[model samples]
Target: MLPASTFVLGGAASGKSEWAEKFIESYDLPMIYLATGQIFDDEVAAKVAKHKNRRDGRWETIEEPLDLAPALASLSEKQAVLIDCATMWLTNHMMQDSDLSTEQDALIEALTACRAPWVIVSNEVGQGIVPENALARQFREAQGRLNIALAQQAGLVVQVVAGLPQSLKGRLP
Candidate 1:
């Protein structure tokens, strides 16, 4: 049987994505990489390419930048889906002036009823100093809230730092 949901959190360049990928790798099920970033420039494009290359043909990619719940709800249980990030997904909604509460509600509901095992990646942004601007502050707050919600959904929660994972919810199962 597939494993329950997982949440991996870390700071920038803290190996969050790599850690999440490794966690998903341990599962023998077909892999699915649910990407949330939108490539707006050459740098972003290069980063996306690097991630694709690192995945090494093991994962089926689903690029969903704005809508994640529907895509998650549509996955097959045979696939272990890795959402390599919540931050970008949140930014996409914030940029569009979408209601965060509704989006988060849908995400939580979908997460509870997803058709497959899910490994979710998200940045730990509240550990740093407070933001200067109002919008930035709001974003941080929203991210914190989302993390908490995701943690509750996940049977396993881990914080990755310098390529090391510290399990928050349960030991590596």
Candidate 2:
């Protein structure tokens, strides 16, 4: 059986989403792909397309960039959810000038109270050099804080480096 919640942390292109997808697919539950990324340009559109092409028809995809509470609350124990990224979710909120603390708290509560098992993908932004600009630095700090909160709420925390998962908290199921 899968844990109630899993946090998959990694750098860009580290295969965290692919690993998490396989992890949840192993349980054979109906899958819900909670996509948080939004495409603003052709490059981003292509990236999104690439991810979409990866999952077969076994997945039901939901595109909600700002509010996820409603989608998450609609889940049942017969299903499993993959929040394909917390980074994009955070970016969406930040772009709209939403209050970070309030939104973060709501997300955490929704994840923990969810009936279905969930795996959340997030970027580990603190390991790199400090961002030079104010906005970039702010985002980096917020992402770091969000990762910490997610790690605390998750039963299993895996850090992916070069596409390999290393358990930093609970054992992988």
lDDT of 2 at 160: 91
Residue by residue across 1-173, what tens digits does model 1's lDDT show?
Answer: 33578999999999989878878988888899999999999998998898888887778899999888788888888878999889999999999999999999988888888888999999999999999999999999999999999999888899999999999887776
The alpha-carbon deviation from the true structure for residue 16 of candidate 2, after best TM-score superposition, in angstroms, is 0.7
Prediction RMSDs, each to the true structure: 1.3, 0.7
Candidate 2 colliding pairs, count = 0
* Cα TM-score of candidate 2: 0.98
> Global CA lDDT of candidate 1, please?
0.89
List candidate 2 stretches off by more than 4 Å.
none
Rate residue 98 of model 2 by lDDT.
Answer: 98
The CA lDDT of each predicted structure is 0.89, 0.94
Q: What would the TM-scores of all predictions be? A: 0.95, 0.98
Worst 10 residues of 2 by lDDT: 1-10
Q: To one decimal, what is the Cα RMSD in angstroms of model 2 from the true structure?
A: 0.7
